[model samples]
Every structure is written in C-alpha cells, then in structure tokens.
Target chain A: MTTSKSNFSKPLILVTNDDGIDAKGINELIKMIDSLGEILVVAPDSPRSGQSSAISSGYPLRLIPVEKKEDFTSFKTNGTPVDCIKLALNFLCDRRPDLLVSGINHGSNAGVSVVYSGTMGAAIEGAIVGIPSAGFSLCSHNPDANFSACSDIVTFTCRKLLEQGLPQSVCLNINIPASDKINGVKVCRQAHGYWTEEYDRRTDPYGKDYFWLTGQFINLEPDNEETDEWALAHNYISVVPTTYDQSAIKYIDTTRNLFSE
Target chain B: MTTSKSNFSKPLILVTNDDGIDAKGINELIKMIDSLGEILVVAPDSPRSGQSSAISSGYPLRLIPVEKKEDFTSFKTNGTPVDCIKLALNFLCDRRPDLLVSGINHGSNAGVSVVYSGTMGAAIEGAIVGIPSAGFSLCSHNPDANFSACSDIVTFTCRKLLEQGLPQSVCLNINIPASDKINGVKVCRQAHGYWTEEYDRRTDPYGKDYFWLTGQFINLEPDNEETDEWALAHNYISVVPTTYDQSAIKYIDTTRNLFSE
Candidate 1:
C-alpha cells in the first residue's frame, strides 16, 4: 500500500455532513476533531437526507463563508454532500486536504443504508480524490441526539486514520450505536439488509394525488455476527472499509456464461 | 439462488429514468422494452443528472399518471430516481414487478461515473426490493444522441435478465459505446478511475460568488483488459454486475488490526 502524503505537523482536515451546516451532529464532530488540525467545514446549507452521492448540476452552487478563526474556518453550500467536497477541493481550500471527516450524522449509515447516505458520500468523494477519509454516524435519527458517548471512539479512530493512512481508494464507514455509555468497537462488513417501503398516498386541494416515502429496514442475515448491522445491534461501533467500485467480481464468470451466445 | 416469484407467462416490468419522463432516452428504452412485458413507466418530472442513489425524504412525493394504455402505463414524479422506484413499488404497481429497467441514460454510466448516476440508482433500488434489474446507458451526453445501435443489445440483455434471474441483491450496469455500427458485448469490471475536478468559479454583478462543476475522467488502469472503460473505448457494449455491498472484505483484517488496542 502506498503511504499517503499527509506528513505535515498540523494536518488540514475537511469536515462536512448531510444534515445541514447547523445540525447538532456536525457540531459534535467539529468539537471532536477541531483540536487536531486546521479544520475547514464545508457542508450543505440544509438537510439533504438520503442524497447518496448526488451532485447538483442543474443550478449554480454558491459557497457562503460562515465563520473563520485561527484553528477553524467554515463555509456552507447550496448543494449536496458530494458537491461540498468538490467545491471545497476546488474553490474553498487553498491546498488539498490531508484528511476528510464527515458526519457524526444523526442516523446510522450501516448496512444497505450507506448507499442512500449523504454523510458517507462526502467521505467517499474525498477518498476518490486521494484523501484519507472517514464518515461517523450515530445510530439515532433524532436531530437532537446526544453524541457525548461517541467522542472517545471518534477521536481514537480519526487519530488512527490520520496516522496510518488508508488503502488507496478506500474509506471508512464508522457507525456508532446510539447510547449514553460506551461499548467496544468492531471491524465488520456491510450487512445484507433492505428497506421494505410503504408509500402514503395523499391528495391536494384540487384532488390531485401525491405520496410520502417511508420504510422499515429488514436485516436479511440476522444471525451473521460479522456484519455491521450485527455489530451495531450488539452495541459495538462498526467500521467497514468501503470501496467505490461496485463490481461483483465473484459473479463475473457466471454472468459471462449467461450472456454468451 | 432462489428463483424470482415472477412465474406468470407474461412478466410485469417497471421502467424508469433519471432524464425525466419525456426525454428521448427513456422513450427509446420504452420503445425497446414495451413489447417484452406489461410495462409501467415511472420517472422524474425533470432532468435529475448526477443524482446517484438519492431519495426524497424531506418533502412529500407525488406520482402523477400521465399515460395509460393496453400494453403500457406511465407516471411522472417530482422526485429523484430512487424515489420513483419506491413510489412505484409501494403504491403504483398492482403487484411486485417481475423486473425493473432504468434508462438509456443520456450519458455514460461507466467506470467511476456509476457512483454519480441516477440511472443506476433506480436499478439498485429494484435489486434491493428483490427484483431482477438493469440500468442502461449510452456513451453520449447529447439529449438527442442516436440510440439505434443500442436497441438490439438492450433488447437481448433485458430478455436474458427476465429469463434468468439475477443473484440476490445484484443488478447490471450496462453501457453502450456511442457508434453507428456496433461491436459485440463484454462482461467487465468497473474500471479504476477518478474525475479530475475543476470548478469554474464565477461572480455575479452584485459581487456574489458562485461555481459550476466540471471535470475530466482519468483512467487509473488503462491497460487492464477486464474493465468497463477499456471495453467502451474499444467499442464493446460493457455489462458490469453491480452490487450494493461496498465492503472491501480483503481489507477487513488489516483494518481490524489497526483499530485493535
């Protein structure tokens, strides 16, 4: 594995989240990582839940400077999570960031949820751009969820990533189980799970129709102990090394056979 | 592998796209697949480029039935690609769809581009819902890009998928090289690649700053023969089996050791 070029005494850390610039989750994350480096916070201007890896191409993005201090600086954008990373790298940051830390997001981005996570998307984008990155999510979806219990693990994991670096093109999806007391940490694979969707149909004053999106998660492999879902359910913080490559290498041969004439 | 529960003589197929309901690409796809089964088209109301796997959670969604006929039905929604699938599966469809097909997308969804594609998101959502699914893209950005050469491959592959069910939670990402004449097909891996991003920064007359996102693709492994980018470059229709499990299993032990005390 190639060593990352993050050798400076004070690393440049880019921070972001999907829950908007003013959310409690991002604020908790800033409190944890602020002392470690020169921090630049570039995040979305409003809540962008389930944004995945979206980039806003239909409109021009505006980056508004929010705050600036000796050890910290902040900006917000009228864009998605991926757009924050792109805007920060291209226009906000004077140089490439050494570390990218996203979230302390309100909800768990474990298992299949990562695919719809704006928090994880920012960190993935950072890894794509050759930065060592990690996304932290508390398992609670409540906006006011307390993150004090997660502080120690967050610090430990972030420091380790800054020190050891990561495999090229890989980032960490760190999910902390929601609690007031700490448990241990676990390195696990993303669990096989899916959302069973239920749409609430409604009508407008003019008798036109609409729908609301709601769902429940069903864990396909409930007995599997090596999955992020299991780890989180057992009250352990789960860290899954994730890659952007979606290729199912094991299924290639069979797929080729089926498609061949 | 479990056989899908789509045992009827005629299959029920769900069609959607990221390029909005009236785009030429989706229309061509509807034309290609309309005869294979009872088809239902549910897509975004406006262009949703770079939407990835995003879902709408903050606002209520609306699915408006636009066209209904003997062989086909269509709806346009004010939501992202994934929202279209969720709404269709939950309230729109009479029963679970036998298959889900998204896009003859206006641009290529090859290599790293897949991570930012709204086209693939709908297919992934379908696979999550236990349906055989595929996302098709033509390697051209023009709205009116000719898809005549792509129709044959689209028909062949979609038929094969409907005949032989996909592995659980796995879907196909198919990209056709832009050409008048076609080469054969290739089952390939997602190529190692990244975008070299450059933001075009601009200022308004009021001196407010805004930026436009633009980038060029950089292939990391140009000589690798088993990759989607290479297949496309050589005029082969590329089919990559894509799964939602982002875990880099090979790196699990090393990651565990790093965080271990």
Candidate 2:
C-alpha cells in the first residue's frame, strides 16, 4: 500500500464497469485513461452484464480493497455496477469526482442494448448525480476481446467530456467497432430496435424443463444512417448522448386525452 | 387445471410485476383488470425489486405452473421482471398479447425511481416489443399495503390503453397515492430528482464491514407542478408517458461538435 497527500489541482476520476473489476475490458479502460487524473476504481467482483441500473438491496454490500497507489486506488464490491457508483459517491471518494467513466465493455451497448447493459447503467447513475460521465463498449463479446482499437476513442471522448461538460442529466454511450482500423466517429441516436428472443428449452436429467435466453436484435429501421446500430454496422464509432430521463414528452397530451375520454 | 379454447374476440392481456407471484400488490392488480380481458401471468417466483431491465443469462431459467383457469393462467419463473416479459413474449404466450401491464408495485416508481424499478422494466420491455403497456404503483412500500384505492385508477387506465393504443415505443408509468380518496389524476413528466444515499455501515462478527442502502429522494424542482413528484404530493395519481429510448436528442448536435473538435 502506498499513501500520499491528495493533489488538489488534478481532477479526480471514478472508474467502474459492469464486467467486474478483474475483466480484461475494465483493466484495458484503466490503462487507457491512466493519465487523465487521480483514479478510483470501484467495480463489481463478478460479472454483472445485463444488469441495467439494478441496485442491490435487502442485504448488506461488502467492499474489498484490491490496490492502492499514490494517485490510483481500486476496490472490488459484491454489488452491481450501479451500486459501485453509489458507494463511490457516498462512501469512498473524499471529494466529488470530476468525471465518471464506465467500461470498455466486452460487448456493444448500442441501440436497445443500453436498457439491459450494466456498463451503461453505471454511466447513467453517474449522470443522474450530475457527474460528467461516459460508457465505452466494443462490438465484441469475447472475454479476451482486444480493446486496442477503442483506446483512442475512449480517451478522446473522456477528454471532451472533461473539457466541455454535458448538459444536465446527460451522459455519453460510446460504441466502437471491433476493428483495428476504425473508419471514423459518428454522433448518433439509439436505434429503435428490439430483440427477437429465442429460448433454448432443454430437459434436465431429472426430467425438469428449463430455458436459456438468446436473441437476435431486430432493428426497426436498419436503413436509418443516424442510429448507433447503423454507425456500428459501417465500422464507425457511435457516440450517443444518453439520458436517464425516460419521459416521452410528446405523448403526454395524447395520453391525457385518452384518460379524459 | 381448466383448459378452454381461446376466445379470439377478447383481448389477450399479459400481467407481471417486480414483486413475486404471491405478492398482494400483483394479485390486487390482477383482480382489478380481470374484466378487461383474458390474462396470462408470467412473473418471478421470488421478489426482484430494483432489477431494471435485467435479463438473466449464462444460466437456465425454470418455470413452474402455479394456477390455471378458463380465462386466467399463471406461471412463475426464476428470473427478473424483465425476464418474465421476455419469456412471456418468446415462450409462454401462445399468440401475441394485445396488452401488457406490470405492477401495482408495492412501492412507487415515480420521479427518478423508474430507472431502478423492475416493475417499469417489465412495462418498458413490453413496449419495446410493440405491445401497448403500462405499469402501476402505489406510493407505499408495505407488503400488505391496502390497494382498494388503486382499483378504479388501475381499471380506468387499463381500459383506456386497451381502447386507444399508445404511440410507438411508449408506455405508461402510473403511480397512485395510498389514500382512500384520491384527489384526481394528472398526466405529468418524470420529475428530475436524485436520491441522497445514506449507507448504514456495520461490522459483522467476522470483523468484516457491510453497508445497507438507504436514501432520501431530493426533488430538484419542488415547486414544479407539472412533474410526477408534485402530482403525487398533491394526492393525485401521476401518469407519465415513459419510453425506453434514452437518447438525449437535444444534445446530439452539441456532442457532435465536441467530438469534432
């Protein structure tokens, strides 16, 4: 363990991920952003993919320190990605974090996938707390997926976020193509899409039936070039400004009319 | 068990909740909307609060048949609320459901709580699949909370949804006050708010420390009467048209500029 006085001038950065602290993706993210500022890594001890904004409750959460250095310290928790952000904000960090970055996730969190992504969940949680935040993901699911192509984009996005803060209640969802030669970057919206789920039903040795979840994403508008899905398909990094506010303002009046009738 | 031929004339309704199969809130919700259509319930076997759009993967999910009747049938699964919706859409329901309703949750899913609510997760999942959907919640966390006051609102809202479908990719988040006489209903937006978390730290007998999550919600705009928090505080049932598309459209251009520079 190494201890030193806090540097007051440098920014404090809180880093977290849904793929757990030991995952290659998160480690890659830390290495990419090491020069950004003072870093605090509080992440889940186990993989928590598909855990979107899920907070652990009805039980106590535990945190174990993994590493400590002069400007970088790390801890692992038996909590979800959102819980890690909450714990860091409320208990761990001595001062408010200047920036919060989550993931160089092993899988893409684009389009409708953000709703089921623990990587985006951490970033959303950070934005909800008024922190400039961003989540980065590669369009690959392999545990040993190479994140080398994402380093430049991740660093660029974080630098921009830190330089020019996002609007209130907004965060960035950045998805990179799994290619060494990235085409370019495109600012896009979440593509309107849904998963066409296929459950693999199987009978156990004891004759009990069970099902495993697997799905193919159905892009409602595949031809729309302004969506994250389209960007990723074209080998471009997609950067979608995301928010936690789910209110559909356009339908408020129509919904009121329906109730009135 | 009772089996009858499907009635094509009557709408097929799918009901689910974050609270487990036996929860009073869900049962009350089922009873309230029974007259609207034939119902199929696919819900978690155990409570899955705070699971927002979380899909269970890398493991097999088991479903147990609980009850069966001519017009009503239910199966409980070892999955999250969102998983229940996916299972219902992909595996359980024989035909496409005309409507999907979740909750009458034991607690409120208003303000910023929707991001953490398994009830809303089910509803959002239903909407993503193009089903007309809604989630109901009472502002009470009591397991045995009285839901008699929520009956009329629940029935009225469901009937309206069945009569006039919502816009694409939209769903309703209807939160009711726990009172015998409700003032009225208000169609409102989600209030901008954040929870001020307070972790109750304790040391176990094994000399390890743990934290229990507890928090108070702080409304960012307390005087805004157009928000759900204000409507709920005024004893009115708050109806927010919610969507799963979290893209911040207003910031897309600004973000593009940031990346370009």
Candidate 3:
C-alpha cells in the first residue's frame, strides 16, 4: 500500500493492452509492475484482437474506472490499445509516465504477427509519442493460458529496461515460452515465417455470408539459428527490437544500379 | 501493343499502395518498377488512411477491376492494402511474381507507425506467405510531392535486392527524404521517435461528439548517424533491415538478474 514517492523520483509506469482488463496475463503483469513503480492501468474494455495499431475514427471513446488494488489504479476504455495509451497521456494521467508497458499478450508477436498485434502496436505508439515503451507476450494462444512463468520474467526485464534504457523510439518485443523451464535468452532476429491465410466460409443464422479469419503459421526460415523462431524452439525467451521505418534502402542502390546507368 | 518481353527478361513486379490508385507517389513508384520489370497494379479503391492492416470482416470484400493501359492488369479492393495484396496473390497474379512492392507512402512510418501502415503491412503479409516483399515510403506527407530524385535510388536498391535476395523473412524499410536533392544511401537504424497524442475534439453535424487523431512526432535520437532519422535528415535514403520478430531476449538475463533469488 506504500504508493507515495518523491514525485519526481518515482518513475510513473503506464500499463495497457489489446487484451481487455480481465485477462489473466494482464492481471499477473499488473502485479509485477505494481511492486515496481507508481502505476496506472488503462486497457481496452474487450478483446480487440488483430486490431494491429489501429486508432478509432468512428466516435470519441470514453473511459470507465476499473477496480483499484493496493498500489495500482485501473481504467478501461472502449478504444483500441493505441487509444488507451493516448487517453492516458492526454487526459487521464496527471503527468507523463516515465515508462509505458503493453501486453503480456495472449500469444507470440515474434514474427509476421507483430503487424497485427495490438499489444506491440500500443507499445510502438507509446514509443512514437516519446514514452519508453514495451510489449510482452507468452508463446501460447490459449485464452486461459498459464502466465506464472511470465510473471518472473516481466519484473526482471522491465526493470533492467528501465535501468539500461532502450534505443530511442525502439520498444522491446518479449515472447516467453509456455513451459516454465526456459533454456535461456537470445537477442535474435525475426524468423522468415508467415501465416497462410485461409478464411472459413460459413452462412450466418440470418442467411447471410460470413468468413472467419483463420490461418496456419509456417516458418520459411527453419535452418536460420539467429532468428526468434530458433530461439523460441530451444525454449529461449526471444527479444527483438522493432520500429516503424519501412524503407527498403539496401534494395534502393541495387535497384538504382539497374536503371541509374 | 506488344505484351511480349523482347529486349528484357527482367522480373515482373506488382506495385501497389494505401494511397489511392491515382496518387502521384504511386504513379512515380510505378514508373520506377516498370523500368526494372513488367509491372502490374492492384491497390485500394481509395485512401485507406490509418486503416492499418484491416481485411474485410463485415462482408465479402468485392473487388472491382481498375481500367488501365496494357502491361498493367489492375484492380481496386474494398478492403485495406493488405487485402489488395491478398487478392493479387490468390486471384489476380497470372503466376507468382518475382517480387511484390508496396507503398511510396506519402508520410514517414519512422518510429511506431509501421504496424499500422497499410503500405508496410501489405508487404509484411506478402513476406509471410513466401514472397520477397518490400515497402517504399517518402518522408513527405504532401499529396503533390515531387518524387523525381528518388526514382534512381529506388531502381538501384530494388534491383539489387531482387538480384541477391533479401535475408529470409527480413524485408527492407526504405525511407527517402522530402528534399529535392539526395545524399547516398545509409544502412541505418530506425530513429527513436514518438508522437505525443493531442486529439482534436469537435462536435459532429448531428451534434454528436467526434475526435480526429493528431499528434506531433518528436525524435529523441538525432546525433546517431546509424539511424534512419539521421540519414533522412542528411538527405540520404535510410535503409533499415526490419523484421517481424518483436522479442526482448537481451533482457532475460537482466530480468533474471533483477528478480530471481
């Protein structure tokens, strides 16, 4: 219950996610950061899956208070994970949090899925807005997955990140394996892997057409030991520093070499 | 009209973007890709701004064919740019193209916006399904951006990449300057930059509340020549090999060091 700190001395940590307030992953994550710093929790009101880094344009979203535990304050919003971070920054927070943490996501964002992950999307948004941010995920996709192993790792990693300081506008993508017995850690590259999209065709009860999103993940870079896929396979937790600059600079010269003459 | 490749057995390129089909930027990109390969076009029907990687969920996304000249078999999708790429891959492509190129986006995806970039997101999705994919973007947000100097660089870099091949699963993030001149290419990192959210509040015509998302981008890392920000600032095309792996392995020991007894 000791929440008071010399206002400037205690780093304020803002926590939010694509998974809504009640997800076990978030609950365990809250408990970890709760013991670390001055805490504020702003999360989506419902499971906003595959939301990517989307923000709302349809209507202005409103925030509602979630229960406050000892040392933690919680609020839920009807916005995307990106909105939660923005709302906390522009309205809810009294001052800027020194740190922003997202997810403890239900599944891995270790490969192509990072583009569709709301967890990392929010964290990336935080980093874009000058908040040192991060996104964490377990390697399991199960809704009620066990997060006990994730709890220990969250504290150690986020603390060190706070201590060491990350590269600017760069947030960490942390994916822990489901088994508690982890091998080690690797600063790995992303594997060449992607989902083969297969939409399920179905007829709704209203006699209308519907297509459900489903896909099987296939790793094209199986032999590549330096990638996140390799690390996760050996039970090593993977960390890849991700960012937003999407320019193909290497190919630029090669491309120019063809026509530049 | 000759549809046959007489003087060239160059690769066939499929170019598209989130910017509307008629965008000057896309037009410039098409000219560059056309020089290197036999090019085709498929893109969003209109601007899918901030749409992220959204695919159709409400209904079957109807695609209407876009009327264009020869050497261009085009279509406009009722979904995001990711949808356009999907349709190109599964339905439209006569055969698997040698490469799939996206964007020449009107703005920068420099820090955290990459995940939500319909341009980069499409290429990311393409890379997943076993195609060598890349997204090109100009740092300028102007609709009438003069993309003249960039053409030589784009052709050079993309041609090289298509020749040597990108490291598996790792695509190029190529960012060009808004300036008229150019510096050479720099293999740099993504700059540490972020947006501090400032939502523009307004009342709709129906007296309903609405908000337009707005924010200023702040770059925290300027002195680093190794970053895309510095490269673009110096009038160089910044190239960073970015991947989908968002793990934080560097912190496993850091976390373990902090928490484990």
lDDT values of the candidates? 0.87, 0.89, 0.72
Cand. 1 Cα-lDDT: 0.87
TM of chain B vs. native, candidate 3? 0.88
Task: Spell out the clash pairs found in candidate 1.
Answer: none
What TM-score did chain B of candidate 1 earn? Answer: 0.94
TM-score of chain B of each: 0.94, 0.96, 0.88
Between prediction 1 and prediction 3, the one with superior TM-score is 1
Worst 10 residues of 3 chain A by lDDT: A1-10
In candidate 1 the C-alpha lDDT for residue B217 amounts to 90
Question: Which of the two, 1 or 2, has more TM-score?
Answer: 2
lDDT tens readout by residue for model 1, B1-261: 111224367788889999999899999998898789878788999999899999898899877768545446777889999998887777667777888999989989999999999999999888887899999999998988999978998899888888898998789999998897667899999998788765777889998878888888999988898999999899999999999889989899889988996
Q: Of the pair 1 and 2, which is ahead by DockQ?
A: 2
Alpha-carbon runs more than 4 Å astray in model 1: A1-8, A68-70, B1-9, B68-70
- The complex in candidate 3 yields a DockQ of 0.24
Candidate 2's TM-score: 0.97
Q: Is candidate 1 or 3 superior in lDDT?
A: 1
* Candidate 2 residue lDDT tens string, B1-261: 122127778888999999899899989898898888888898899899999999888588987888655358888999999888887777667678889999979989999999999999999998898999999999999999999989988888888888888899999999999987789999999999899955888899998889998888999998999999999999999999999999999999989899887
The DockQ for candidate 2, computed on C-alphas, is 0.84
